[model samples]
Target chain A: MKSADKHRKIIRAATKVFAKKGFFNARISDIAKEAKVADGTIYLYFKNKFDILISVFEQEIGKLIENILLLLENETDPSAQLEIFIQRHLEEMKKNRNLAEVIHIELRQTNKLIRDYRKNKFSEYLDIIAKIILQGQNEGKFRQDINPDIAKLMLFGTLDEISRLWGPGSEEKVTVEDISRQITAIFKHGMLH
Target chain B: MKSADKHRKIIRAATKVFAKKGFFNARISDIAKEAKVADGTIYLYFKNKFDILISVFEQEIGKLIENILLLLENETDPSAQLEIFIQRHLEEMKKNRNLAEVIHIELRQTNKLIRDYRKNKFSEYLDIIAKIILQGQNEGKFRQDINPDIAKLMLFGTLDEISRLWGPGSEEKVTVEDISRQITAIFKHGMLH
Candidate 1:
């Protein structure tokens, strides 16, 4: 296998291992075993288990950020852009339960390294929402009084809380589309009649 | 000291210890020392460290639930009740940063016992938000189309994400009141013009 392929294989395996056994319980050897690679070969690609965990987030979230930017480029209306963002976010989590579990659960690790990494990458993801809100305000479609910073938190927080229910072994009665629609409706238009 | 007072004192000390040291790193001896009691005295009030953690949540969150219930009783308008709810929730977190840290970070622990306890107590707290929405719909003040379950998640999730920024040693430029107002406005009136 090429170096790039081997690196990708290890990340994929780590996502599954971390999701299954959690970051603290998961061992580097376990990741190597799952990847069908020698334990020594694992060190060639990554420094340690913490390094692998951070790599998992960096790669997955980087892909998500890139995808959202590409997807949003085609839409002009901020409202529609916001809808697409919610739909895509929920859809991605629904399809990638392991990555979602790893991101949701492990992101809360109290370590300074993970916390700082999360702050930077997570803020970048959240900035997407803030930009949408700012665009809506500029277009005069959204309320001027609303703060983009707080609004972004509200939007991401809602999507995240909803995702917490989508853990493995749990059956969800609501479809991802249902969640996207419900969430978009609430944020686009206030709950007031 | 009275048994009840000693129990309360130990809980207070444990909150500081748990906040300072992540739950995994925190020892019963640390809690006992902080409380100025013998190490064995902790086991007298609780079964183990996990039991103490749960008790802290139960005692603190239980008080929050009780207070919100009492405070909301004075207001009949659902909108006003929601503003009050958001205000009180954020205020409690601001007043009790240690409790906030423990609840915010420790609640995400992957253990089944903590997870189940969190689901139950956290749901009870979130149900307060749902009940407000339900009351608003019944009063014909809020939109009838919204799902209280999803709305509750949005409200709690937003508050939670915001609270994550309020960890110790960090200075927040935005006041708790500013956050509550901003969040309440977005949820109550939304972003759309």
Candidate 2:
């Protein structure tokens, strides 16, 4: 298999392993077996389990960022871009529940080193949303006085909490599109009348 | 001394010990030493170390809930209530950084049993916010169509993310009132023009 294909396979396998056995307890040998590759092949692709975990995050969030940027390219209105930004984010998380579980729960339960790494990796993603907020303000589509950092954190934090609660046994029975629209409505227009 | 006073003292000392030594490594003796009480005395107030941690959360968050309810008693406006809610919440966290650090970071990094207990304790606080949102809708202060649960999550999550970032040397250099107003403005008005 190609290096890229092998890399992708390792990530896919690792996501399942980490999600099932958890990040700390999960061994590279387990991931290697799941990926149908030799143990040494895993080392060539990733430095270690920590590298694999970070790689999974970087790849997953990177793809979501790419999708958001691509979707925004054809859209002109900042409101629309913001709405699509939320929609695509929920859609991405919903599409990969295993990855979402790891990112949301397992990674958080890791050590200080992993937590710092997660925070570092997450900053890049936050910058993407920050830029969107900045653009919205520049276009006069968003509130000019609002701090873009706070606004971005509001948007990210809400979606994150929602996604964390959005699991197998949600009583609300809401669809992804439904949730996306609800979140967009709240963000675009305040919850108060 | 009264049983309640000793109980309070034990919790206070445990919060400090847990914050310093971390939850997993913290022992009952360390807490007893800090509280200046006998090891057996702690067992009278709490069943075990885990029980002490949960009680610390219960007392801290319980007091916060009580304060929020008390502040909202005279205020009829939903927006104002929400603002005060955010303010009091931030103020409490600010007053006790060690406890805040333990609650936000250490508890999350603990075992599943602790995590689940934390979740259960947090739901009560979320319900308080949900009631405020529902009351806002009833009073025509908030949008009628917005989901109270989702809005509560937004408010809580935003404040949480902000607190996590807020520390001894934060880059923002903003006051608690400033952040409360910024957050309240977003929840009450939103980002859109």
Could you give candidate 1's per-residue lDDT for residues A54-90 as a string of tens digits?
9999999899999999999999999999999999998
Provide backbone clash counts, one per model: 0, 0
lDDT of 1 by residue, B81-148 (tens): 99999999888888898878776767765444476776788789999999999999999999998989
Worst 10 residues of 1 chain B by lDDT: B104-113
Clashes of 1: 0
Please give the DockQ score of every candidate, comma-separated: 0.76, 0.54
Q: What's the residue-level lDDT of B160 in candidate 1?
A: 81
Off by over 4 Å in 1: A38-41
DockQ of 2: 0.54
lDDT of 1: 0.85
Which one wins on TM-score? 1
